[model samples]
Target: MKQRNILISGLSLVLMTSVSSVAMAQCTATGTAAGFAPQYAPFAVGGALNTLVSSINAANTAFLTQSTAFVGSPANPKPDQEGGGIWARGIGGEINTKNTVSSTYALGGNGSTFQPVATPLTGGVNCNTTTNLQFAGTQVGTDMARLNWNGWNVHMGSMAGYLGARARDTTAATPGINAGGSLSNSLEVPFVGAYAAATYGSFFIDGQIRWDFYQNTINDPIQNGLFNQKIDARGLAFTANAGYNFQLGNNWFIEPSAGIVISQVKVDPLRATGTLLLTGAGSIPNTTTFSNIESYLARLSVRVGTTIVSDKMIWQPFVTASVYHDFAGAAKAAYSESNNPAFEALSFPLIQGNLTANNLGTYGQFALGIAGQVAGTGWLGYLRADYRTGDRIEGYSLNGGLRYQFTPDML
Candidate 1:
């Protein structure tokens, strides 16, 4: 009775944290910031990839950790689950994050040289701009089935979902030159993935593969409405994980795990308007295209965690932390040119650029969860809260799931 009360309290606390974290992510995603499209546009691919990988990792870890705790000790495993058993589990959850890009810009020559120039802008707009790209969604759901025979167990699962970010900036301007002008930038992507895992004795191995289809659009309402671009991309990602478990005393155990992830993305460019902000007097080009628009990213991570068993109610609580590094994968943008008269008049050369991988530079994540058997049935339940930082992609997530154990006796 008393143990049940404590378990309930813990569950309530976890739920509250989960809700708050999600709210915060949503707020960050919708916030406004400065605009630097011409420079930052090249790096949109990195931001999209980061958000996708983070969400998938969070959901997978939450369920996998809970399943490990339920397995208990191999030496004295439960007789009702000994010979062989199968369990089915389903999880529904959400993830939120923010992706930012920064760049430096100059007006090519004089910001004061605009035709029909009003008030003759002084010195021109030469400065640095950082664009905050936000992403949020709530459809991270998964279904899995585990089969165990002897001391070996295998699990298979599938995940399907979508997330999006749209950044609009109307406040950006080069002083009095282009006031009240707006920039509409948006990115939307959908993904489907599958995973498989196997456990033998105290060692575990898991792998996942995902495909992402993305569309991005950017429009500048200023400068003859030129420089608007639409991009479509497809990406493939793969990751593998391995871990070893160690038992300490009777009710405590720890596991150390490592994994690597890689992604390859290819983008198709659509017709674009002009180069930079140019007046209607400038001849706007009908179409713009980019070549060799391909990018890649790779990362490796190490994680450590421990599970604590309770004296009553068969409750188990776990905590985990991970540190990850980015190995390589930087991309470049194709050169762009416009036949608009503004290009020759202003002496603006074709713009060619590169996008450095976000790298994330050694980010870390922490998570806490609790799982247990429900009194008299073969049902198990779990709740987890996850927080991550020190990377271009920062996220907060909450997950809850139910699993049904089919004991050998029942079979």
Candidate 2:
């Protein structure tokens, strides 16, 4: 009976020990699955939970700091976690992509003329004649442009523009007692141009090209006869420029630029008479034919300016000075001739003389303007005036235009 009791007790002890071992194994497996140390599973799990909370807190703090920096506020408490920094990245700069169109008209009059004469003389009967003349000319022009990107900040854009001129003289006349006659001349010139420019860090570069066309007509009547003349001319010009801006206090800035303009021109002249056409002639006889001429010219310019900006508006005022070199081309002739017999019989005297190579002169000009954005929108506008003085011509010009922004990426 003592041996039976001892065996039973031993079996009970083994069963209890096996159950405890299984429970310990299960705990070790769970610890490994949860990525914790097996000997200190509970403590390791608690430490990991605390670490995760700390990581989340740090992230929240960083986000708050960035948010505060964006709103021009450094010490403000965290509000709703909203994205506000994107719009502040380029706040002080301006970008323009719209087009601007403008037109201008001008008129001026000032000219002089002189005449030489020949007469017949006989013994005790002599006749002599001499004449001098004065006249005035009216000048008119139209100027237009497609775009202008002028702002306080960086920008990229393109422009297309044109300028045209017309001049006429009504008081010009020919001389002689029996030479009851009248003479007049008219001229028209047109130009078209296009350009592109980009700006970065107070610096900008631009390139442009232009084409010009000119037409001229002259009418003169002498001794009951009529004369007509026509001339056609064409020109091409190009410019490349680089500029820098200096910022001054009080909403002011100054920009100076240097540029080179190259131009080429060609001219053709023709003349005819009407009296010869009536005498068995369908074509009016030609009295003179002037040789065609070509010219190459160079020019330079500089500009200075400033700008002011508010929430919904911007304003800029600028001034520019420019000069051009003498032209290099064929010389104008004082007189020309033809073999038509009717021209020889009437002996029509020389009319207006031609411009010589030495007569080609240099010119300079000054211009001022203002450009800015409209209130409450991205629209742009400008007003400008200019005065030009030179050896060849002098005049004043005025222009204005507006543009509307069509794309966000353009600004």
Candidate 3:
């Protein structure tokens, strides 16, 4: 009877120990799941901030590069022993010899009639030269992910990145301007940004905003009359888009999207290059009151995309292409140098001509990306490249990031 009692006690002891071990293992897994949320939350927030800043930097660099190509002192006769210096700073600075036309008179010799014959001449002065400016290359990076719960999908994220652009001229070598040369220029913009998206049924919409700070450099030959200048700027931009997802059959889908972007910003001038370019005067210090300039841009785009979803693995891959058109915008100066005695005679508008808004031709973009779920969470990444047939703008973007979803239960 005592042996029977001992056996029963041993079985009970083993059962209790096994149950306790299972309980501990379960608690550990639950704790890890809870802890992951806190860790990932901060990481995601920081990433969004960084990407917003990066986007702003890219926009500013593009703006400045385009402005340089459109604005500058006109070509003039070489500063020769003649009155070339005066012309270089005066009428020559205002007129592009390449596009200028003038009339001259041929005198009738004593053997012919006294009336002078009129003649037209079309040619750039032999001493006159023109230099074109452009940003040699530009690149942008962003990281963003998405979240889904119940019937709605929400994606909000950020990224940090870099963009670089160089200024080149027609006169520069085939490879174009190096780090040096008056016409050669370059800019590096560091930034951060945030983007958010929401979807209901087949309809979805998204938007992103960015802020950036940048430093720019310009090198131009002296014949152009304007000295080399450096510019710094802080900028802000916003873009919003709407689209509809059309389910094809199986896991295939197509989405058509439309979007608009509006941007506003200003540059803090380190030098009054505008004043010098117009009047051929010496460099003037840029003051907030006198040198402040404002710029605005608005653009529209349409996109078509296709998606492939794999059920075996939690992966969704997509390809999208878009075309953008600039509709309206302007860059203007607050104060006109026309009031100043030195500039009044030249009839210089207080605003630089380049600051005046004009159409920046059209451009296109192609993007490819993949998204998937990990450990019941979500993530996404993509890359895009842009091009324009004209000399206006060109660039590329690389993006990767995370996402979170809110469900009806959470709501």
Candidate 4:
């Protein structure tokens, strides 16, 4: 009887152990569902690229339209030299940032074994961005640093203040992001920059250099399904232009210009450094690095205008047409999460993903502008209606500004 009782107890204990092992077989993924979200990789990266390019282009356009068409060309009568001065300008506009985003994401690592089920992320996204820039500062002339030499005229303006740029996903029920609404992004970086233009004889040149930040913001950090922290990026961008001034007659003139832009941008990795609980025996590492982004843009423009002089005021009116193209290819982002050398990446439902964005090829623009100056006050003002004529990225802006020359007579 004793021997039989020992055998029964041993078998019962073995059976209990088996049941416990089977009960804990499921490897639960811990941390916020966002920690495991593979769908957002493309949406964030692609949206960010679109925003960066659009912002750069917006700054370029603002710089181009801020001034009048009356360059110091031999075709028109030369006005007396006006000393250094101050200027204040404001610009508010909107542009269409269309992107073709595609991604590959993994799901269903719930089984007891290591496996990844990749889901196609081909649902397109449409984001129209609203942009605002304010500029106010001193301009250099012959009186300041000999900035003007021979017949050359140069003035520098600074754009340093709070800038607003917002891009929201307007699509209907963007899949894999929420249960009811789409994911929206906002750029919180403050914009700052400077622009310079010089005119010598029948030749002219203008350019601008500005700092570009690539951070992205969403309305809700936590999605109904999953979400993560905001992404951060930073870079530098600059635009250069050159042109020659010619005349059709004493009152009419023609101007042709060429411009180019070059920039270097970098995107920060997601969950750069952190470890999440695996709910079983190990931890999940969160980290990903995007490829380097280097881009170049080129454009051409032509302007025709006439100068009108009257007793009370002088007016310069012109119309401009231009075509531009971006030479950058799409950015391909690589994703990885297994940082622990000892930890097995394929053990659970670990994710492997990739994302990319299409580049906007060629765009056109049309603008109408008028500049005027008071006969005796030495005060100059300009107003321009600028429009993007391309179907892919069409938009418009009404920009205006006031400038004053600080001369001895004024004092």
How many residue pairs clash per model?
A: 1, 2, 25, 2
Q: Model 4 misses residue 130 by how many Å? A: 14
Across 6-100, the per-residue lDDT of candidate 4 in tens digits comes to 11111110000000000000111222333334232333323333333344344333333332222221122135444455555555565554444
Best candidate, lDDT? 4
Question: Residue 49 in model 2: shift from native, Å?
Answer: 99
lDDT for each of the candidates? Answer: 0.41, 0.31, 0.31, 0.46
Tens digits of per-residue lDDT, candidate 1, 1-411, equal 322322222122122111112211110111111122222122221232223223233223222322221221122233323322233333333333333322222222222233232331112112212223344433332333343456555555665556465543322333322232245456666767776665665677767777777676666534324244666667677766666656665545566666665655666654545424354333234332332322222223332333343442447677767665555432333323343565546644232222232333445667787766554444555766666565343555565555444441231
Q: Give candidate 1's whole-model lDDT.
A: 0.41
Report the lDDT of model 1 for residue 324. Answer: 55
What is candidate 3's lDDT per residue for 136-216, written digit by digit as tens?
A: 222233322233344444444554445455433322111111111124445666656665555555566666676656666
Q: What is the lDDT of residue 206 in candidate 1?
A: 67
Off by over 4 Å in 2: 1-164, 169-194, 222-230, 274-300, 327-331, 341-360, 408-410
Displacement of the residue 380 alpha carbon in candidate 3, Å: 3.8
Q: Report each candidate's C-alpha RMSD, comma-separated, in the order given.
A: 9.6, 40.4, 27.7, 22.9
Candidate 2 at residue 66, lDDT?
14
TM-score of 1: 0.58
